[model samples]
Target: MTSAFSLKRTLNLARWNAVLLTRNRLAFVYAVVLPVLPILIMLAGERGDPAVGATSITTVFLVVGLFPVYYNVLSQFVSRRDELVLKRMRTGETRDAEMIVSIALPGIVSALVISAVVVPLSQLFEQPLPVNPVLYAAAAVLAVIMFTAFAYWTAAWTRSAEAAQLTSMPIILLASLGPLGASLADSNETLARIIDATPGAAMNELVRVGWFGFDGAEATEKTLSFAETWSAAGPPLIVMAAWTIAACSLASRSMRWEPRS
Candidate 1:
């Protein structure tokens, strides 16, 4: 027989998910508008820049497109996870894993929708197709998962749902400016070495390389060398994994079913 707590938690998640999503119009805009706006801006700028061809423009577009979808949406998810509703649901039948997944599902769906809109629209506007679709696709999926997990980890430190907006700002800001960070790091060996040690920088580098089709054995060798030297992506992925594990452990240990004191 189904446990009473699980049933109640599931019901609570379904109810709160709908209510919060419907009530928060700003959340809706952030999901839909923020990612798409950069694409529009890129299209507009492409008309004037003779030097900026389809490939470069598409690269910029992809990087910009990901900011709102992954960063903003995930931030919002983390923030919302701390609500009284969530606190109450934890008291019910739902497992901690179930609660987190249910909370994230809506935002994940929205991110996927934005991604769908981005690809075709980019092509329709004559932006070149991504050079390495497989690599890009992998990077995007990895990014979403990593960021989502990171959001939860961040939420653990946050005091309340209201604080999510402020607490999440640093991540959103970093993600929004990731491309710039990547470029700057690329030029400065020392800075690049430092940024390469950052959490999301490897994903950024991989995506940029994949999107731009920096291929051949030489490129692969260089990427692998960079991977070994800076150990950017590998270390971050491991850190994210550890963070996810730790977050789960913490949630299991500290999570309260009833409202916070």
Candidate 2:
């Protein structure tokens, strides 16, 4: 007979996994330091400036999703499988879904924590409170789903934890496209369209609309009212949703639970 789903057991495993993640100094840097660096840079040079506000927060949001959520999750799955931990766990009461969720939980929480802190912290730089906090919340939720799925999907080809460094480069470069999407639009509209269709650019759009109140890609004299934000969010939302679905599907198809020869 199958065991019933248990939230308590899942959380316990997640807690232990979190401890492991935090203990690694390099992982610690990815989880904490890299995500916050953009904000610190903005503060040191342009304290309380609104112009860079959305850029800074969006950078933190995207950075957190990439390293902690994406890279760490990829590394953990590879390392655990190589050590036979995943295979061993399967011999017991743990369900496959439960195990996967638990493995992805810590990075999800770290991403959320960074997202939450940035809202209040943005005020320190004299930026206004987010005009559409709901959009911010929505983006954060989608980010966790998308990036974590990306990690699992990427883990399929990763031979070992060390191999993760090379495997994760495409994702890193994908994320790097976020900040450059708008700039690219000016010179090469077609290339810019492709970038905008990507998950990172979709996130950048959401941040620009939700946090800074820009209307779509173009800034106007007035900030968008409450209702306009949702309309602006629609395209990016679709892009992110499509990517999320693709990632989850690929992860399920390709993930390996046992060590390689």
Candidate 3:
């Protein structure tokens, strides 16, 4: 049972998150401007050659776009989680769940905005609409949840706000450079198998479905036929789910209400 007042406060906090994000010029650029730049570059470049197909371009953009939105936002949120602002909110009527929601609201909104921009822009180059919009949406939402939780967990271990950016580098780099996740989403059986094992690979697969319609059967066949190895993409989804749970559990157990002791 939730109260209207609590909901209102949560909404207000969400809005405040957006305002605070805008105030930080660096964060604003990281969240908004950075993701779109590559897309523009791709659009302006040559649109020929199967090597640079719609599927590949979209896959690249999706992966590139998520870095600034997910990594930066998560790092920022986690870095600030122990600030006086969060401490003050925790002492008030704001529930822990609401606090988390409020903290995440800005990133969520920014991701949505970035997606809106990317989808149409990709379409302008003749990329097909998602075959399964439902699954695509599910993957996108799950990605938001997974990365948000991961960021919080990372923040819990982080020593300071400055370290937030540094601490987040591994996940960011992995998401960017990991095998098959972004690079092999279109092809490369070996890479795809490797990507299926990584943390954020499921979302990469889902984005492929959105951009190029990757069905379960097709994915399974691709794995079996080309890769000659059964990928754990399905299992990776489970792993991602587990990551969500683990991140939440870790944050609950170790998250400091204020700066380190």
Candidate 4:
């Protein structure tokens, strides 16, 4: 095989993973049903309010990010590594980056596909199309990449596929902090900043701005044009980029090809 990364091989691996995911009932529930169920519930109660719809959109991506993008990848990588699957792949034509991306591709694609369906579904509840579609697209892509990297980094410390559940809680909660933590941290600006700095919150902020054109602090009546939306997105974009870089660095440094045990 040539030293060049093989898209064909990566795609073939991704297809296999897609099939495995569909065949495994529990994984199917985790990857597809669980991420989408709550969003549907939220949309049902939207009452034609755009804000509610926007929030539903944000929640959809956040839930998908945590479950399929982060947790599933972590568990899958750990299981594969413990099985010596990752080790075997390294001895073959699979490059490290290709192996990692292919393993993550299923969950990543699941996330994007679910988002595509749900975004349109939200419209049935009277949710308007995004005010800044660019931001939504950018946030989704960045979030998937960020969470995929974080999953690999988390797998480095995960002892087994089983242990991934326990190891994953901190990240799950952190990604989920959002405005709930904001309410809790209301008395403490420092805590609020920390919560907003999380990868999850950054992505949520992007979703909010993409849909509403203004964040919580800004006036609800305020509307920004496409260029202005980018200005408003600066902080969240910084937070996301920083987190992705940090996660990628740690994953590269500590990721394990063999079982911890």
Looking at candidate 3, what is the lDDT of residue 205? 55
Candidate 2, residues 1-261, lDDT tens digits: the string is: 567778988999999998998899998888767887877755865665555787787788788889879998899899999999999999988888888899889888888988889888878777777788899899899988999999999999999999999999998888779788877787888898899898898988888888778775546323788789889889999999999999999999987899777
lDDT of each: 0.52, 0.85, 0.60, 0.82
Candidate 4 error regions (>4 Å) = 217-222
Candidate 2 local Cα displacement, residue 71, angstroms: 0.3
Structural similarity to truth (TM-score) of each candidate:
0.68, 0.95, 0.77, 0.93
In candidate 3, list every pair of residues with a backbone clash: none
Q: Which stretches of candidate 2 lie over 4 Å from their true place?
A: 45-48, 218-222
lDDT of 4 at 28: 76
Give the per-residue lDDT of model 4 (tens digit) for 1-261. 558888998999989988988998888788888888767655467467665666677788888898788988898889999899999989987888888988899999989988778767776776667788778888889989999988999998999999998999988887888746546566888887888888777887788887667655323433777788888999999999999999999999997899855
The most accurate candidate by lDDT is 2
Scored against the true structure, residue 129 in model 1 reaches a CA lDDT of 50
RMSD, every candidate, angstroms: 6.0, 1.6, 5.3, 1.9
User: Once model 3 is optimally superposed onto the true structure by TM-score, how far is the C-alpha of residue 80 displaced, in angstroms?
Assistant: 3.4
| Pairs with backbone N, CA or C atoms under 3 Å apart (clashes), candidate 1 | 5-92, 5-93, 6-93, 91-257
In terms of lDDT, which candidate is stronger, 1 or 4? 4
Candidate 2 C-alpha RMSD relative to the actual structure:
1.6
Between the candidate structures 3 and 4, which one is better when assessed by TM-score?
Answer: 4
